[model samples]
Target: MRSIRLTRMDWRDPAFAAGLTLFLVIGTPLVPRGQGIEIQLDPLGYTLLIVSGLTLAFRRVAPTAVLAVTSLATIVYYYFAYPGFFQPSAALVSLYTVAALGARWTALVSGAALCAGLLLISFRPAGLPDRQAFDGPLWVGGWFAAVIVAAETARQRKAYLNEVEQRAVDALRTKEEAAKLRATEERLRIARELHDSLTHAISLVNAQINVAAHLFDRDPDRSRTALFAVKDASKQAMGELRSALEVLRHDDEPERPHSLRQLPDLVKASEQQGVAVKVTVSGDSPAVSQHVDLAAYRIVQESLTNAARHSRASTVSVDVRYDYDKVTVRIEDDGEADSSSVVREGVGIRGMRERVAALGGEFEVGPRPTRGFAVKAVLPLGRSEDDNGGTA
Candidate 1:
C-alpha cells in the first residue's frame, strides 16, 4: 500500500458507489436461503444491508472507518440468523480499498477477524468439527487475499508509470537548458570573430580610398598606388571573411589559423595605406599556445587600423617582446598631441581589450607620452605545455 493511483480527477466516484450500493441492496435478499434457516430477513436485516453498502461511498476518503462499518454490519446481520448466506459486497470492496491505500497488514488482520466472526454463524451441532465447518471461513479468507493482491498490483503499476513520466520531463528540461547555453556561446564566438577581422579590413579600405581621392588630381602615379591599395585591402577583407565563415559552413576548426608570423604582412598592408611603420622585436621567443599567438597578432593588427583611422601621424612603431611567461605587443603613432584630436574608445578598442582579457592578459590604449596615440596588450601563456607551439 506504498502507492496510490489518484493521478487525475475522478468525477465518476459518486455514480459508481451509488450503482454498487443499489446492486447489493437489491441482490443480497434474492440469494437462496441457507439450510436450517430458521428466520426470514426483517426490517432490521434490510437496514444492516443498506448501511453496509452505503458505507462504501467514502472508502477512499475514510477507508478504515468504511471497512469497520461494513464489516460490523455484515457480522451483525449474520449473527441474527438471517436466511440469506451472501456476505455484503461493500465489506469486500472496503477491505480492498484499505490494502490499496497501503495498509496491507491491517486489511489482512481485519479479514481474519471477519472470518472468525462469520465462522460462528456457519457452525452447527450436526456439522461436528468437519471439512464443511471450515469451508465458509476458508472461502472468505481466499477472497480477501485475492483482493489485496489485485489492489497492490494495481498500485505498483501506477507508481512505475508516474516515475517514468517524471524522468522524461526532467530529461527534456535538461536538454533544453543545454541547447540554450550552446546557442549563447556560439553567438558570442561569431560576433567576436567577425568584429575582429572585418573591422580591420574596412578601416584599411577607408584609408586608401581617402588617399586615392585626395591624390587623383595632384599625382596620377601616387593615386594609382592608392587605388591598388584599396583593391588589395578589399580582397584581403573578403578572403579573411570567407575563411572565417568557412569554419561555420563546415562546422569545423579554422583552416587558416592565425599566428604572430603574420605580423610582417600586417605591417606591409598598413604601409600601403600610407602609414610608415617601424617594427621592433626583442627577447628570445618561446613556443606559445595558438590562442596566445592569435591574440598578439590581432592586437597589433587592430592597433594599426586604429592609428590609420584616427591619428594624423604618418610613422607608427610596432613592438613585440617575448618573455618567459608572456608575449607583449605595442603600437604607437606620432599623431598630433592636441587633446581635441584624441579619439574615444569604440568597438575596435573594446574588441582588442576583450581578446586580451579572454586570455587573462593586460590591455592599454590611450594618448601617447608627448604627441601621439598608443595601444599595448600583454597576453599570458597559462599552461605548462601549449598546443600549436606557435611562435610568439
Candidate 2:
C-alpha cells in the first residue's frame, strides 16, 4: 500500500498540493461588497464556486473534462449574475492543459469557445460597463494567448531534447563497433607474423633430430654435432617467438626492425639444416621506410624457409643489390628441375606477396631455365623519416 501511494499523485508532489491549495483560496468568496466589488451568493452561486475549485484536484488526469464541467458551471453562474472571479481563472487553467497535451485542432477549438463565451458575456444586459468593454476583452484574450504560447514552447523544447539524446547514443554505438573491428585486424596480423617467424626454424630442428638419431651408433661424434645443431635451432626459435610475444604484450614498446643486418644469422641457421648458403650484398645499405625494410626481411625469411624445407639443393645463393631508388633481393638454389613446384604458392608465399605489394614493391618466384628455383623481390626506397623525431 505504501509503495502504491508513492507511485500515485500523493502529498509528496509539491505541484499536486500547490494546485489544490491555490484553487481553494481563489475560488472561495473572500472579497467584501465595496468599491464596486460584490460577494453575494445564493445556494447556486456557492455550489458553482465549490465544484469549480474541487474539480482542479484531477486537472492533470482529466484536463478536458474538468475544463468542460467548470466552464459550464461558471457560464450558468454569470447568466444568473453571480458576483465572483474564481470560475474564469479555473477556465484559463483548463485552456492551458488543452494546449499542452491535446491536438492542435482541439486546443484551437477550445480557445475559440472561450473567446466566444467571454464575448457573449460582455454584450449581455448585466455585462461590463460601457467604459470597460474595449479594455476588458483585450486584456482577457491576451492573457489566454500567453498561456497557450507557454504550453506550446514547453512541448517543442521537450522534443528537441529527446532528438539530441538519440544522436549521442548512435555516435557511441558507432565508436564501439569501430574499436571491435580494429581489435580483430590486430589479432590476424599477430597470427600471420608468428607463423612466418617460427615454421622454418622448427623444421630445421626436426631435421637435425632425425640426423642425430640415424648416426648415434655408427658415428658418435657426428651424432653429437647434429644434437648441438638441434639445440641451437630450438633456442633461436624460442628467442624469435619471445620477441614476437613481447611486442604483443606491450604494444607501446618499439618493435626491433628486421633488415639486412639479420641476413648473416639467417644464412647460418639454414646452413645448420644441411643447406650450404652463399650471401652477397653489393652497394651501400641505405636507410629506407620501416614498412619497406620489414617487407624486404620477411621476403628473404620466407624464401630461405621454403628452400630449406622443399629444395634438395646442396648449395643456395642469396644476392642483394641496393640501388639509388630501390633494393633488390634474389635467392637461387641449384636443386632439382622441379624445385620451384616444391614451394607451392601457399600461405607463406601469399604473405610475402602481400607484404611487398602493400609497400608498392615487385615480387617474383619461379624455376630457373636450367635447374633450380629463384625468388626475387624489388622494394622501393624512401627517406627514413618517421612520425617520431628519429629515423625509421
Which pairs clash inside model 1?
A: 1-102
Number of the predicted model whose lDDT against the real structure is largest: 1
Question: lDDT by residue for model 1 over 1-392, one digit each (tens)?
Answer: 33432323245655667787677667776877655643676888878877777667777777888899988987887677675555556788988888877787878888889989878766755432566677767777788889989978976787799899999999999999999998786766566667777887887888778888998999989889988887888898898888777867876656456778887888888888778999999988777776778778878887787777768679999899988888888888987745445557777787788788878999888886677888889889654235344434
List, residue by residue over 184-205, the lDDT tens digit for candidate 2. Answer: 7667556657767788778888
Off by over 4 Å in 2: 1-26, 31-113, 134-137, 156-160, 219-222, 248-251, 274-286, 310-392
Please state the error at residue 349 of candidate 1 in Å: 4.0
Deviating ranges (above 4 Å) for candidate 1: 1-164, 282-287, 311-317, 323-326, 330-346, 353-392
